[model samples]
Target: MTDIIDLRSSLANRVQRWLAGSLDQMSDEELLKLVEAQSPAETIAELLVATPTRRAADDDWTDLLLRGAEAKNQIARLAGGLLSSSQAAEVLRISVPGVKQRLERGKLLAVPLPGGQRGFPALQFQRDGHVRKGIAEVAKAGAHLDPWALLAILVDGGAEGGTLLERLDDEAVLRDVLSRLAGYGEHAAA
Candidate 1:
């Protein structure tokens, strides 16, 4: 009887994981739409981190958990947007060594690539052949965070609850995101 129960449990877990994986295969646009329709990243994060004053409804809890998973998947999507060091150097009109110096100075962000190399995020570059200054500010301010965490905060955070990258041109959103990045952006008071 116990063996039968254990077999059933294992099967159930596998089925659940398969379902989640299937849902995670949505296009980035579709995933963002679903996540926004249910809850913004900030709200989901706040709820996950904050101690509850009362019992949340079961549906609410389930939705919150699922939204958190969706956010993780979104971060994974951003991984494909990474640029090789040489590629980044070309984009910014700088030498590869210059790019490395910026990384050491917290003026740029990079994620670990296979074989122990770094890949800069392409999202930070602008149309005029310059990198976004705000990314450097956020990196410098949020120096306490790991590179991947910093990337998530940059691409996913905004005051109005839209993806920060979507409003890269908005002065208000830029201020709000910087102020909110580490509970304080670069311009925030100590």
Candidate 2:
């Protein structure tokens, strides 16, 4: 454990030096643009060590942390059941472009995977190799929402009295639940 801790410390110091060198090489405008493009995880990690700015209150930092944790948890859950686009295409016996088209048309659901690629949940397909019924309708209804949010509704239980995954076979129940979720999304957007 001591050796592990020492190794981690050494790695962290190296990273800190690397980041410092990189930041020093960037123009102010470039630095701002790079910061703007950072993912929530990267932003959160930076904020943990960053000096509090005059524009941001302590409460604002806390809120950012909470939001970051939520995003992290969502991503972890997504990765747990995720299939790469290629894997999904293979499973569906469709071309990669076809898989992407399905996602774009809301015929299938997907979320942005960690490395800037999309990941489709395995639950979206049936054992018989068909897209699960009622999912497209749900996806269409929740089209305004983030794909990750739609995925959370489907996988996480107790929102509409139970998990949507188990109710996918029941068109009526699934649609009803999805409708309610879509309404929530719409309201939130409003």
Deviating ranges (above 4 Å) for candidate 2: 1-80, 159-162, 185-190
What's the true lDDT of residue 90 in model 2?
Answer: 90
The C-alpha lDDT values of all candidates are 0.64, 0.68
Q: Would you estimate the TM-scores of all the predictions?
A: 0.52, 0.59
Give the per-residue lDDT of model 1 (tens digit) for 1-190. 2223544655566546544554455466655555565456654454333323423235464556456545544664663366778988998899999999988987877876546778777777776758775776777777766666766867775457656754656787778767766574445455
lDDT score, candidate 2, position 154: 73
Best by lDDT: 2
User: Which 10-residue window of candidate 2 scores lowest in summed lDDT?
Assistant: 48-57
Per-residue lDDT for 146 in model 1? 65
Residue clash pairs of candidate 2: none
Evaluated against the true structure, the overall lDDT of model 2 is: 0.68
Predicted model with the maximum TM-score = 2
Output the lDDT of residue 40, model 2.
67
User: Which regions of candidate 1 are displaced past 4 Å?
Assistant: 1-73, 157-162, 184-190
Clashing pairs in 1: 178-185
